[model samples]
Target: MTRCLRRIAPLALALCHLAAATPAAAQESAAAEALFDRGLADMEAGKYETGCASIAESHRIEPKPGALFTLAICESRWGRVASAFTRFGDYLALYEQMTPDQKSRQGERAKVARKERDRLGPLVPELSLSLPPGAPAGTVVKRDGRAVDGALLGKGVPVEPGEHVVSTQAPGGPVWETRIQLAEGEKKRVALQVNGASTAAPSGGISGRRTAAFVAGGVGVAGLVLGGVTGALTLGKKSVVEEHCGSAIGVSDETACDQTGIDAAESASTTGLVSTIGFGLGLAGLGAAAVLFLTEPKQGEEAAAATSRRIRARVLAAGPDGVVIGARGAW
Candidate 1:
C-alpha cells in the first residue's frame, strides 16, 4: 500500500497543482469547455485512452494551452514517451504568452513537464532511416503509414516503442518495405536498398496447377460416371442376348443364332469396349488430378521455376485391342 501510494502521489500532485488553462476559458466554445472537463474527469478515473482521445478532440476543436498540457500528461501516462515529449514541447511554447498571474499559476506545471520530458528522453524509441546514395528524386519514405518529411531522412527521429513498418518508394521504381520491432529506449538505423523485385500479389485467384487439378478431377469424375453407365448397358445387352439365345445354340450344336440374339451380342461387345476405354481414361485422369493437386508449388521464384517439372499425363488407345493410360514427369 505504501509503495502504491508513492507511485500515485506524483500524478496526484501534478493534477492538483497544474492549472488546466494558462488563460481564462472564456474564449472557448461551451462544447470545447465541456469536453475538456470530461477529459480531465476521465483521466482522473483512469480511463486513459478515452481521456486522451477526448482531450485531443477538445484541442482540435479549440486550441488551448491547458488541453496541450493535459494531452502531454495523458500521453506520458499512456507510455507513449515520444508523443508526450513532443506535446510537452508544445506546451512550453505557451509559457512566453502567459500573464504574470498565469505564469505563476503554470510555473510548477511547466517545471514538472520539463522534468518529465527529460526523464523520457532516454526511454524513447528512435529510428534513423537512410536511402541509398543516388536514390531517385521524388522518393518518399513512410514510417508506420505516415509519410516522413524528406528533410528528416538520415536523421534519428523518436517513435513509439513497438512494431513499425518502414517503406520507401520512388516514382517508377521498386518499393522497399520492412518491419521493425523496438523495445523501450531502443535505437535503430536502417539503410534501404532498392531492387527490381516486384511486390507479390495474388494472381488469377488460384494457382495454375491447382486449377488444372480441379478441372482434371472434374473430368475424371465425369468419365467415371460414363464408364459406369456404359458398363451397365453392356451387362444389360449381354443379359438380353443370353435370354434370346437360351438353349437354342447349344442343344443341336448347329442351330444358327437368330438376328435378335446376334444383334444383342454385337451391341454388348461394342458397349463393353466403350466401357473399357472410359475406365482407362477415367483412371488416368484421376491419377493426373492427384499429381497436379499434390504438386502445387509454394510461393516465390522457386515455384515459378518448378512449373517445368510438373507432371504430364495422357490417355490413348493402346491399339485395336484396348485403351492405354500413361504419365511422366516430376511431381
Candidate 2:
C-alpha cells in the first residue's frame, strides 16, 4: 500500500499543478484572437480563401459571432449566408451569456463596425480546389508543400496566397494534379493533366521501312539484270567469233582471224564471271540493309544512354514477345 501511494501521490500533484498552470478558457480566447487577426491579414493580402478558413476556426473556438459574421461576409463578400446564419445563432447565444457592461460595449462596437464591415461582407467568388491530367490515379496533389485530397477537376475558385494543395483520384485512369497560388480577386484557369498509354501507333512508320526494303530488293534485281546483260553480251560475242573463226579456217588459212576469235572468246568468259559475282554481292548487301532497318535499337545502346530518353512499357502475352525484362537500377 505504501509503494502504490508513493506512485499515485506524485501523479496527483503533477495533475493539480498542470491544471493550475493552464487557464483553458483564457487560452482559447487568446488563440481565437490570434487566429482572427491572421485571417484578416490573409484577407488584406488577397488570400480571401485562407482568410476565411482562419476566421472560421477562430469563431469556432471562442464563439465570436462578430468575428464569424465578419469572416462569412469578407470570405465571400457575405455570400455564405448559410454559414453566417449558423454562426449568428451561436453568436447570440454567447451574447446572452455576457455581462451587461460587455453587452453594452459590444452593441456600440457592432454599430460602428457593422456599418463599415457590411459593405465588405461576402467575398465574391468563393475559393475551391482542383487537380491536373497525367497525375497517377488516387494520388494526392501537392500545393505549398502540403497534400490536399479530393481536389475536383477544372478551374478552382481563387485561393489566398502562400500555397494550397489539390488531392485527386481516378479509377482505372491516370492520377491528376495541379498547384496554384491566388491573390485577392485573382482569377485563373487551372489545368489538370493525366498520363496513360497511347492507343494507336503512328502512321507511315513501319510501312515506310517496308517500302524501303522493297526498293532495295528492286536494286538487287537491277544488279541481276546487269549481270545477265553482261553475260549475254559475252556469250554472243564469243559465239560470233567462233563462227567466223571456223568459217575462215575452212575457207582459207588466216592466222589473224583465228587469233581474233580466241581473244574475243576469252574476254567474254571473264566478263561473265565478274558479272555473276557482282550480282550475288549486291543482293547480299540489300538483304543486310533491310534487316538493319526492321530491327529495334539494340539493348546495348539502350543501357549506355539513359539521359532523358523516351521510355515505353509493354506487356507481351505470348511467344517471343511475351518476356519480362528487368533493368538493374540505382536510386
Candidate 3:
C-alpha cells in the first residue's frame, strides 16, 4: 500500500497542476475567440477598414489558420489582389499541415485561392535578369535595392507592375545600374555590364558605412510602423476590456476580472511592447540616416563624376594609304 501511494501521489499531484493551468489557458483562448467574433461581425457589416484591423489583431493574439484564411478573403474582397495572392500563398503553406478531415473542410478555400492565382498569373509582370558574358565571377545583382537570390539570377522573377531599378557590383568593378518600367503581363530582360578594370571610378562613391546606415534606417522605420499599429490595437483592446470588466463592475483584481477583460488587457500589453519597439526602431533609423549623410561626401563630387562620363565620340578612319584619327568633345 505504501509503494502504491508513493507512485499514485506523484501522478495525482501532476494532474492537479495541469488542471490548475487549464483555466488560464482557457480564458486566453476565450478572449481570442471574442475578438475574432467581433472582427467577423465587422467584416459582415462591410466596415472593412475596422474589420480588417480587428482581424489582424485577432491573428496577432493567437495565430491560427482560419484567421489567416479569413484575412486572405478580406484582402481579396477589398481588391488588393496582390496582397490577397500573397496571403493565399501563406494560407496554402499552413494548410498543408492539416489532417485529411481538416483539409476537406478547407477545400473550398483552397479552390478559391488556386482560381485567383491562375487568373492573376497571366496578368502579373515579370523581370528576366542577366549579366553580360565574361562578367566578373562573383558579380552580385540586386533589384530595388534587395539582393537577388543566386538561383533567381538569369531567370524570370515575378514582380508587381511598376518602375524598378536594377543594379550590380563586383569586386574590382564599377557599379552598373539601370531602371525599367513594366506593365501588366510584361516580361522585360535586363543585362548588366561588369565594368572593366580600366574604367574610371565614380567620384566619392557611396561607402560601405553609408550603405549600412541606409539599410539600418529602413529597418528602423519598419519597426516604428509596426509599433504604431500594435499600439493602436492595444488601446482598442484595453477599451473593450474596461467596458466589460472595470472597477465599477466589482472586478478590482485581475483574477476576478471577466475573461474578455483579461484577454483584452493581455493583448493591450503585447501591443504596448510592440509600440515601444517600433518607436525605438524609428529613432534609430533617423539617427543612422543622419550620421551616414553627414559623413558621406557632398553632391559636388557626384556631379563632377557625372560630368566626366559625358564624352561625345572618337572616330578612326582607315583609308587605302594611311590611318586618320579625329575626336569630338562635349564643349
**Top candidate, metric TM-score:** 1
Q: Would you estimate the TM-scores of all the predictions?
A: 0.49, 0.32, 0.43
Which structure is stronger by TM-score: 1 or 2? 1
Comparing 2 and 3 on lDDT, the stronger one: 3
Candidate 2 lDDT, 35-121, residue by residue in tens: 999989888787877888888899889865578556745644434433543444445556678788888867654444444344333
Q: Is candidate 1 or candidate 3 better by TM-score?
A: 1
Q: Residue-wise lDDT of candidate 1 within 1-331, one digit each (tens)?
A: 9999999999988876565553345446677888888988998888989999989999998987878999999989988889998999888878777898988977588888889989988999989998775566777889888899989988988999999998888887777899999888999999875554232323224656677888888887887787789999999997777766747556443334678888988998898888876776676678778877665566664456566565566554443344555566673
For each candidate, how many residue pairs have backbone atoms clashing (under 3 Å)? 0, 24, 0
TM value for model 3: 0.43
11: Cα error in model 3, Å: 4.3
Q: Could you tell which candidate, 1 or 3, scores higher by lDDT?
A: 1
Q: Tens-digit lDDT track for model 3 on 159-180? A: 7677888888887778888889
Model 2 is weakest, by summed lDDT over 10 consecutive residues, at 313-322
Candidate 2 accuracy as lDDT: 0.56
Q: Ten residues in a row with the worst lDDT in model 1?
A: 196-205
Please give the distance, in angstroms, between residue 101's alpha carbon in candidate 2 and its true position after superposition.
27
